[model samples]
Target chain A: METDLGLWAVPIAMLGGAIRVSTPILFVSLGETLTERSGRINLGLEGTLVFGAMSGYALAVMTGSPWLGVIAAAITGALFGLVHGLICSLPKVNDIAIGIAMMLLGMGLAFYFGKPFIQPVAPDLPAIPLGWWSDLPQVRAALQVNVLFLIGLVAAGVLWWMLKATKIGLTLRVVGDSTDAARALGLTPSLVRTLATAAGGAFAGIGGAYLSLYYPGSWNEGISSGQGLMAVALVIFARWNPIACVGAAMLFGAAGALGPALQTIGVSSGYYLFYAAPYVLTLGVLIATSSPTQALSGAPGELSINK
Target chain B: MTLPKFSRRTFLSTSAALAAGAAFGPLPARAAGGMTVGFIYVGPKDDFGYNQAHAEGAAAVAAMDGVTIVEEENVAETTDVQKSMESMINFDGASLIFPTSFGYFDPHVLEVAPKYPDVRFEHAAGLWTEGMPSNIGSYFGYIGMGQYLNGITAGHMTASKKIGFVAAKPIPQVLLNINSFLLGARAVDPSITCQVIFTGEWSLAVKEAEATNALADAGCDVITCHVDGPKVVMETAAGRGCYICGYHADQSPLAPEKYLTGAEWNWAGVYPKMVQTMLDGGTIPNFLRGGLADGFVKMSPLGPAVTDAARTQFEATKAEIMKGGFQVIKGPLKDNKGNEIAGAGEGFAEDDIRLESMDYLVEGVIGATS
Candidate 1:
C-alpha cells in the first residue's frame, strides 16, 4: 500500500489535479491581469467568479448547451464589470469598496439566479490527453488533462507577448504604470481601466464556467469554495503576469488536492492542517517575494498596493 | 384572485415589494388575473436541496387554480425576509405568503403576521406560535426517516463499521439527521460508529470535499452528507473509492462507482394536495407534518449495485416505519457517554420532547459540538 503512494503518485496526481483545479484560477488571474494592465483593480472579481458559476450552470441547463453556459457566464461577468466600472467612474465612489459591494451583489445574484440549475444535468467539458507517449499508466493518467489547461497556457503566452510587444498592450501598461502619464499622452485612464476591467470580467466569467462545465459540470450553490477570492492572492503572486499565473495556480491546485491524495496513502491525522495548505503557500510566497521598499519585479509601477 | 390588468412589463408585479415572478419547474409565466400568491426564499430556489424542493412545490401550486405564485429568490437575512414579507403584503397583493426559511420565525414572521391579518402566511421549519396570527401556521418534514434509511445503507457498506457524516450547522435539523443516521446504522450493524464534521454552510462544495476527504482519511468507507449539493461529494469519492449517499436527489449518475444510494424529499406528493385543498376553499392546514404515508419524503433511486441483503433489510425496515410500527428515535436510547438515556425499560415519548432542539449525539456517534 505504501508503494501505492510513492513520490511518483503524489506528483502524478498533482499534475492531473493541478490542471483540473487550476483552470478556474487561470481564468480569473488572467482576467485580473487584464484589469490591472489598464490601471485598475477589481476586488469584485471574486463575486464575479461565483456569480458566473451560478449563472453559467443555470444557463447551460436551461439552454441545453454547456458552451452557451460559458458564453452566458462571460456576458454576465462583463455586465458585472460594467456595473463596477460605472460605480467607480461616478464622482466620489471608491473602487475598492464598490468592488466589495459588487462582490456581495454578484454573489447574491448568483445565489438567486443559480437556484434552479443546482440539480439539472448540463454538458460536461471534454478532456484532451497528450500523455499517450508515456507507457506508464500513472504518467498517462497525469497527461489526461483538459483542453482548457492547454488554452490557459496558450492564453498566458499570448497575453505575455501582447503586453510585451503590441500597441494596445503598451498603452495598457502605460496606463497602469502612470495615470498622469496616460493623461499627458492623451489617453483616458478610466477608459482603459474600464475596457480592461470588462476583459477581466470576461476572464472571471470563463473561470466560473470552468468550475461548472469542466472540473465538474453540474450546478450547486456549493460549487465554488473560494476560487474567485483566492484568485486575488494568486494575481499578487503572479505579479500581473499571465505566465506566472499558470504556475502559481497549478501550485495552489496541488496544495488543494493534498488532503485527497494523502488519504489514498492512509495518512488521516492532522487532516484539518491539510485544509490550510493553499492559503499557507499563498501567504508564504507573497511574503517571500514581497519587498517592503523596492518595487516588485514585473509589477506595474502606478499600482497602489504594489508601490 | 387579483390580476391587476397585465401590462407586458409588469406581468409579475402584483404590488409586493420586489416580489418578482419566479419559475418552479419546466414552465415560468406571470399569472395574469390569477390569485397571485408570494413565496420568499432565504436562498436560491434551485439549491437542488431543501430550497429546490420548496420551489418545486410552490410551482406545482401555481399550475392549478386561482393561484399564481411569485418568489423573491435569495432574499437576505430576517430583516430582508421581513421587508420581503411587507413587499408581498403592501406592495404585491400576496394573500398567502410562504416564508421558506428557518430563521424567519418569531422576530420576522410573528412580528409581521399579526399586522397583516388579511394575508395568510406559512412559515417553513418554524415552531413558535405565541405571537403568530390566526392566518399563519408552521410546517416541516420528518426528514429523519430518509436519514435513517441512508444510515442503514451506510451500516451495510462499512466493512470496518466506521462511517462519516458531513453536515452544515449543528442546528436541530442537522442534528436530527446525525442522531437518526446513527440509530439507523446501529439498527443494522449495532457496532457502526459514525464521525461527523461540520462545514457550517449548506453550500460550499470545496469545503465539503475537503471535509469528506478528511473523513475518508479517517477510515470512513461509507459517507453521507446533509449539504445543498452532491457534486463535490460524488466527485471526491469518485477516485478515492469511498461509498456515498446523497441528500435531496439521486446523484448516482454523477459518480456511479461511488454513489451507494441517496435519500430525497418528494414535493410532488405533497404540493398538489395542498394546492387542491386551497382550491377547495380550505386554508393550508397549520403545522402539517408529512411522512412516507403522505409521500412528502422519499428515498432516491437505490443504485443498481445495492446488495440483496441490504435491499431486503431496507424494505422490511421501511414497511415497519411506514406502518408507524417503528420509530428510529424510540426506546433504549443512550447519549454518546455510557450513561443510560432512558429508564432501563422505557421509551422516549414524542409528547415529552421536541425533536428540533436535540443536541446530543446518541450512542455510537463520534461527533462534537459547534
Candidate 2:
C-alpha cells in the first residue's frame, strides 16, 4: 500500500482537505451570516460550536447513529442561542458583552457535562466517495467528502435564495436595515432578531457536529482550536454574503491545510509559518477589502459593529 | 490547543478533598509527622495520555504510608499553577509538590519554588541547571528507548518497510523519539525508512488525524506518535487499517487488533521511590533521569500482530537495555542532512547529557527538525 503519488498528491490532498476542513467554517459563517443579517451578532457561536460538538458526539455514541447526534447538537446550540438572544433583547444590554459571557457559559457547561464523553467512541458520519471513478488512491482519499459538506453547499445556496427573493427574507432585511423602518411595518425587531439568532446557532451546532462526528470525530476538551471564533473573521471577510462565505471558508481551509500538505511531499521549511497562514490570509483579506472611510458593503445597518 | 482549565466545581471539590484529607488522613506510625504531597496536571487525569501516566504515578504515591496525596487535575500551565501550588502549600499543608506538566517548570515553578524555599517542587521533563533553586528539581524518563522497542515490533510487522511518526512538535524529547524509532527499525531491516510529520502543537486532533491519514497514504504500514494524547492518532491509523504503536500510556484498548506495541511511562515505579526517599528523611536528587534499566519506562504488551521473531528481538533488546550502557544514537550516524552526529566509531551512551539536547533527525527520517 504505497500511498505516494509524487507531486500530484499535494494538490489532490489539499483539495480534499480544503473541502473537509471548510465544512465547519462554511456552516459557521453561514450561521453567523444569518444572525448578522437579522441585525444581531452572536460572538457566542464559539461556545455554541463547542457545545454542539460535545452533545453531538455524546448522542452519537449513545444512540449509535451520527445523525441523531447532529440533531442533538443543533437543538443544544439553538437553546444556547435562545438564551443569548433573550438576554440581548433587554434594555441597556450590550450584545457583544452578553455574547462573550454566553461563550464562556456555553463552554463551561459543555466541559462540565462533556467530561464522561471524553473516552467514548462515536460512529463517524459517512463520506460520499465522490471519486469512486478514480483509480488513484490519493484521488479517492481526497474525494471522500462527508455528507455534511453537501448539506452545507445546499445550505449556502438555500440561505442565499431565502435572504434574497422570499418575503421572509424581505422582512429580515427590513428589520436589519433599520429598526424604525421595521416598526413602521409593524414588525417586532427583537422577535425577528431572536429567531434569526437561534437559527444561526442551529447552523453553528451542525458545524460542530461536522467536527466531532466527521473530520476529527472525537469529543475532547481541545477538539476545537477556535474554529468557532475564526468563523467570525471569515464571515466579515466574505462581505456578509453566504455564497462568498463558502469561497472564503475553502480558501481558509486550503491555507490551514497548506502546512501538512507540504509536509506530505517532504517540504518542511517554514512549517510554523504555515500554521499562521489562515490568520494571515484573514488579515490580508480584511485589509484589502475594507476602507477607513466607509462601512463594509452588505453589513447590516442595525448590526452593532456597524453602529 | 489550550489545555483544559480547572472549573469552579472542580476547584471546590479539590478543596473539599484537601481539607478532608488534611483532617483525617494520618498513618498510625507517623500520625503526627505525616507529610502532605500535591500533584497537579495540565489536563484531565484520565485522558489516557500523558496526564494519565502522571496520575497513575500520583495514585501509586497515594497508596504509600505516611503520605497524604492531594491531586488537582486540569490545572493550566499558566500562573494558575502558581496559585494551585500556593494553595497546596498554604491550605493543604503540602511540603512536596509534583507539577507534572513540562510547561509548568519554567517561570511558574521557578517563581514559586524560591518563594517557598522549604517546599520542594519536582517538575517532569524540565532541565534543572546549577543556577536553579535547590528546592526545584526535575525528573524525566528516557522514553525514547521505549519508542525504540516499539519500532522493533513495527519494523517486524511492517509490510511496506516504511514506518510513520505523527509528532506534536519538533522539540528535543520528540525528536529523540523519532530518531530512536527509526534507529530501532533500521536495526531490524537496514532498508526501513521512517517518515515524520509535525503537527506543531500537542493536542490538535484535526492535524493529528490528517497526519496519520497522510502517513498511511504515503505507504506507511505501521504508525507511531509522540503527542500529548495519542488517542486521535491511534484511532485514525487503526481506522485506516494501519498498524499503530502508541505513546505516553497504554492505548491497546483504542485499536486492539491494529495495536502493535507502545511506549509508556512507568512513573508508578519512579514516583513512589522518590516520595518514599523523601519520607525517609533523605534528599531527592535535583536532576534525575532513568530509562528501562532504571524502571522509569516500560513497553505496552506486544499485540497479536507482532511476530515471534519480533518478540524474541524485543525481549533480547529489553534484556540488553536492563543491563545498561545501551547506546541507541551511536557510531556511523549522520543526521538526515548528511551532517555527522557522531564519527564512524563514536557513540553516545543512553545517559549522555548531549542526547538531552538533540536537535537533528537521524539519517533515515524524512522530516526536518525546524
Model number with the top lDDT = 2
User: For model 2, how does the per-residue alpha-carbon lDDT over A1-307 read when each residue is reduced to its tens digit?
Assistant: 6646888767776787788789989988999999899999899998999999999999999999999999999999899889988998999899999989988988888888998988778899999889899887767777888999999999999999999999999999999999999999999999999999899999999999999998888888788779989997788898889999999998888777777777868898778898788899889888887789877888989999988
lDDT of 2 at A4: 61
Kindly list the per-residue Cα lDDT of model 1 for residues A1-307, writing each as its tens digit. Answer: 0122354555666666676688889889999888877767788988899888877788777787777888888998998888887777677667778888988888878867675566666776667768788665545545657777788889999999999999999999999998789899999887788888888898899889888876655566556767888897688799888899999999988787775555444443455576578898888888987889876777777665654
Question: What lDDT tens digits, residue by residue, belong to model 2 across residues B1-370?
Answer: 5657755544774677667678878432234588888999887777779988998999999998878889987788898998899878766778899999888888889988987898899989947999999998899998989999998998899888999999988888999999999999998998999999999888888888778877877778899998888888888889778999989999999889999889999999999999988888898999999998888899999999888999999999989988998989998899999999998778887888898899999998998888
Docking class of 2: medium
> How many steric clashes does model 1 contain?
12
Model 1: residues with Cα > 4 Å off, grouped in runs: A1-22, A47-119, A126-172, A179-199, A220-226, A237-299, A304-307, B1-37, B129-136, B157-162, B212-221, B231-244, B249-261, B266-290, B330-346, B349-354
Reference-based TM-score, model 2 = 0.94
- lDDT value for model 2: 0.88
Which candidate's DockQ is highest? 2
Question: In candidate 1, what are the lDDT values of residues B244-288, reduced to their tens digit?
Answer: 887776667777766767777776577667656665679886767
DockQ of each: 0.21, 0.53
Off by over 4 Å in 2: B1-33
